[model samples]
Structure formats: C-alpha cells, structure tokens
Target: MGHPLLRRRLLLSLPLAAATAGGLGFYILLERARQGTYNPQTFSNPLVGHRVPDFRLVGIDGKHGFGSSQLIASKKPILLNFFASWCVPCAGEAPYLDVISKSGVDIWGIAYQDKAKALAFYLAKYGDPYTRLATDPTGRTAINFGVYGVPESFLIAPGGIVRWHIAGPLVPPIINEQLRPELQKIA
Candidate 1:
C-alpha cells in the first residue's frame, strides 16, 4: 500500500490538475473566438438541402400572404427572412435587405408575433424590401422551420429546397462573403 501522506498529497493534486486543464481548454476556446476563427453560434440545420416546411401564414398589414406552394413555384431562388419589429438586429439588417432587393434578389419577410401597427411602423422607419410579407402570430410556422430565434434567414431554391440558412441577422460581411457565393451556386 502507498504511504498515507503520499496518498493524501496525490489526491489533493488531482483536483488542481483537473482545474488547470479545464482552465487551459477554456482559454484556448476564448482565444480562438477572439481570433475570429471560431464561431460560438455555428450550428447545422437539418432543414438545409431539404424542402421548406409547409406553412400558410396570414398577411401582415395588408401585404399578401405566402405559403410553401409559392416558394416551390418560384422560378428563381428566394430569401425567406424571419424577423420581428421588436428585434434590433432585424432593424440593423433592413438597409442591407433593401440593397439586396435592389440588386434583384427576392426577399420574403415573415413577421414573427408582431402586431400590424408595429410592423407598419417598423417598415416605415426601415425601408420595406420584401416582395411579400406574412405574419406568424403563433410562431408555429417558425417552429416548423426550425427557427432558433428571430432574424434568421433561409435561402430557398426553385422547387422550395432550402439551400442555406443563417441563424443571425444578414450583415454586410455575411451577405458579401457567404450568402452571395451560395446564391451564385444556385444561379
């Protein structure tokens, strides 16, 4: 048997060793994140490469509603954006959406649990860039689309196949680097 003092010392050192290893691992992750080489929000979407979920949403603020059939019938790819009037990031992406729309990309906006008046005000404040607008009052449609949160977007190719998805706001970098390249592949 080992000496009692040695055994006690060894047992005490084990916790310190574990703590040191854990701290090192956490530090490495933080460094990677700071270096822009790691994305904590990176995740895979099972819906990608599959058809968009079937849904029928009512129109918001007198805009025409949309359904899966419309997406499937589209002649070209479309960007389906799930946003809310209350979302700050959604507002931040508004200008980019307008620019993208002006560039001839189709964007369909879905308001998630937002009131008509608020949605109208939001659209008025931020230029309306959506070709069509729908309301998911119960957020059931968003649930079906595997939406993690508001301001998510899906790129649906002709026939309603979801080619790509982003779980965050569509900022300039994402639009230029990732979204445009993916659209080119389908185009």
Candidate 2:
C-alpha cells in the first residue's frame, strides 16, 4: 500500500490537476478565437433561411397557443425569441425586447425547457412583451430552430422564411444595425 502521506498528497493534487486542465482548455479556446477560426457551437443556425417547423405549443396564459403560422402570417416582420426563465442573459435582454414589441413589432416567445409556473412568474417580474408565448418544455421546438442556447432570436419574413438569426441577447447595436434594417424590408 502507499504511505498515508503519499495518499494525502495525491488527493490534494486532484484539484490542481483539474484547474490546470480547465485553464488549458480555456487557453486553447482563446487561441482558436485569436486565429479567426473560432466557430462557437452557437455561432450559426442551420435553420436560417429555411421554413419554420410547424409546432403547436400551449401558452402560459392557459387560454391560447401558437405555431409557425403565427410568425409567418404577420403583416409586419415577426421576431421569434427563444428564452428560458432560468437564463441570465434572457433576463438582461427582456426589457429591450419589451421595447421592441411596443414599437409595433410582433414577437413570439418560445419558452425553452421551462415550466408554466416559472414562465408566469418570470413574465410577471420582467414584463410580458410577447404577442404570444409558447412553451417548449421538451426542447423539441428548440432543436427544429437549431437553438443551442437561450436568448436566440429569428426574424421571420412574411412568407414564412427565416430572414436573419441572432444567437445572443438583443443588444441596442444589434437591434439597430442588424434587426432594424431587415425589419424595414419586410415592412
């Protein structure tokens, strides 16, 4: 058997080894990004420019539901936002989304892997900006949209085709520079 001191030393090295591995992983990611070859797992949606998948999800309100048609038939451009109550960036981006909704844009919020009670509480806390909110607790719909993370959004044109996709929170610059210009075309 090993000496007791040797066993203790080995045990104590576990955390150091784990930390070194984690640091090395991060450094590799950084170097990859610096080389301009970094494609984040969430960097692009394969569903972009494709027809939205048909899905019928019940709303948190318990009164209505929505599907791809709701997004496709909008007179104005529709923004389909995928979020979860548990997501931090979703919370941070909520207010701006509310503002966008109020500016005559149609927004359909998809609750990815979230429960109804939590969604109600989240909306009550953050403000409900969704024209209609649909629950995707099973993550089936998220897969159809090529969503790997929360706070992703798709701009669907009037003909049911996805125009552009944003795989992050709706910041002001993105809203202005990317979204607004595209919205104008569909307007």
Candidate 3:
C-alpha cells in the first residue's frame, strides 16, 4: 500500500537489521567465552548429587562383572570412569588415572563399546588403574550414568551418590585443580 520505492527500501532494510542482530549475539557469546565464564564443554547432568542409577554391566570377560549393589556397598569413595579403547583422550588420561589410583582412590572403569581384546591391549600398554572393570559394549550403562561420551568421569561418594562429574580427560591440571579438591572435601 505504500510507495513502491519505500516498500523496496523497507524490504532491503529487514535483512540488514536481522544480520546486525545476529552479529551482536555472536559478539556477546565471544565476549563471554573470552571472560572464561562460558565454557562450551560445560554441561549440567541431572544425575549429579543423586544416587547412581541401577545397572548390571558384565566385565570384559563376561564372567566378572559389577552391579549397582557393588557400588553401593563400597566403604569409600570411588571414581567411575567411562572410556573406550579407541578414544585418544582416554589414552591420554591413562597415566594420570594410574597416579590417582596409587593415591588409594578406587577407580571403576566401564569400557564403552569396546572389545575385550582391544581393551586388554589398551590396558597392557597404558597401565590399568581400575580396581574393578566392567564392559558396557552397548553403552546402556553409560546412558544410565548420563555419560555424554567416552572419557567422562563421575566421583561417587561412599554410598554411591554421584557428587561430581567431569566430561573430559583427567589431565594434570584437572587432577591438581579440580579432582584433588573434590577428593579432599570427601575426605
């Protein structure tokens, strides 16, 4: 209903306005990232601060396995780790896990979608730090644990409540800065 030239200008301006808004949104996200307040890797799991879900996972050999009862019956805190032989980060964290285990912490490993043979070789090469190992070949146990991917870890308290979780490899910085502090709190 307006003049043709005015109508054309308005239509052209809409795209520019939309693009400007998009740019502004991107800038805000970038600023947040720069400020260290927005980590893209950070995700909230509903399982934190709650009891670990019920699961029965067979070990790599299918004969030796672990269940929810085993975890709940533990007298001390445990680190539940989900890893796969094929994950590079899992390999990277292997040594640190060994160190942590040496410090008297129990680490329970769940091999996610990995073959027994491959896991055996991986442990032989990387050094097995798990006090107990189980296999989650179908990843069902991981789903119950709310694991997003391999190399995720949950700190379970004496009674099997998941007090903390980290969705990455347990590198030195994480060991010293985050995991150690959490361990002290429970101790």
- Model 2 TM-score is 0.76
lDDT pick, better of 2 and 3 = 3
What are the candidates' C-alpha RMSDs?
5.4, 11.2, 6.8
Candidate 3 at 142: error in angstroms?
0.5
Tens digits of per-residue lDDT, candidate 2, 1-187, equal 7999999999999999999999999999888555433436556677778889888888775767788877677666789999999999999999999899989898889999998888889999999998887888899988988888898999999878999998888877678878999988777
lDDT of 3 by residue, 98-127 (tens): 999999999999999999899999999999
Off by over 4 Å in 1: 1-38
> Which portions of model 2 miss their true places by more than 4 Å?
1-41
Q: Rank the candidates by TM-score, best first.
A: 1, 3, 2
Worst 10 residues of 1 by lDDT: 32-41
Model 2 has a clash total of 0
Better candidate by lDDT, 1 or 3: 1
Instruction: Estimate every model's Cα lDDT from 0 to 1.
Output: 0.90, 0.86, 0.89
1 or 3, greater by TM-score = 1
Measured by C-alpha RMSD in angstroms, how accurate is candidate 3? Answer: 6.8
